[model samples]
Target: MPRTREPFWRRLLAGTLPLLVWSLHFAFAYGLAAAQCTPAGMRPGGPDRALLGAVTLAAIGACAWLAWRAREVPRREDAGLLDWARLVLAVLALVAVAWTGVPLLLVTGCA
Candidate 1:
């Protein structure tokens, strides 16, 4: 049987989605931290660690889901470039999200 090819746009989207999520998470995390630390921007009580943590977890979960879906069913022996790309990118994003969240555990308050 011949291998079915995915559309160019779909392959591209799957491959880039993980990286995009990672980038967004990076920007949001740092931006939130910076904003919270600023005297004028700080929340009434303090930093919102819970919200940040929740977002981190959600990002990690999304990346994991993408990676799992990339594996696909039927267990093909010969996966294409897009398949590999999607799996690799998802795992990379998962690690990046986790690493980015590390400061949340170590740091408390803006000080």
Candidate 2:
């Protein structure tokens, strides 16, 4: 049988969301560390930093869900195991964000 093709948007979302999430995650992590290390006494072990992390993760999760639902539309059936794996990873990542994010936020006073 011929291979199916995914729509442009579906492919775009699938490719972009994870990257966006990861970048945000890393940026926040590093940002907090740097901010804390600066002369400003701003530390990562505060509530505000933790809140930022949690919020960032939540946003990532929401975006991933949106992407997943979008993929369910009339997109091409060419989606393979890898495609599904990526989506699953996105979800798992979101969960990780929540798990680690909440505590971080609470401790950091970012909440």
Candidate 3:
């Protein structure tokens, strides 16, 4: 039997899930940092930090799982232009993460 093709939106979602997960991580990290530094009595090395750490780890795990599932999808030779656009956006996101940490460390003098 011939394999059934996945819908366009479903395929797009599969490819984009990693970006969504990483964006959520960035937002959560920024919010956590702000919360820690703000004058709200929420210390950095407390229960809140622990909770955020757990949540972040779980997000990472979920992202990995989604990526694996995405890889299992059958490739199409005739994707629409929009699909190509989404793939390009996903590549840019991956590149952003790859390059961001080094500059972040250099600017912050963390290295």
Q: Which candidate is the best by TM-score?
A: 1
**Candidate with better lDDT, 1 vs 2:** 1
- Most accurate candidate by lDDT: 1
In candidate 1, which residue ranges exceed 4 Å CA deviation? Answer: 1-5, 43-46, 72-75
Candidates' C-alpha lDDT? 0.85, 0.60, 0.54
Ranking by TM-score: 1, 3, 2
User: What does candidate 1's lDDT look like per residue over 1-111, in tens digits?
Assistant: 776587678779988999999999999988888888898887664568888889999999999999888866237778777778888899899999999988874567776
Tell me the TM-score of each prediction against the true structure.
Answer: 0.84, 0.53, 0.54
How many angstroms is residue 4 displaced in model 3 relative to the true structure, after the best TM-score fit? 8.4
Clashing pairs in 3: none
| Model 2 lDDT per residue over 55-105, tens place | 675666675675576465335586765566556656666665555455455
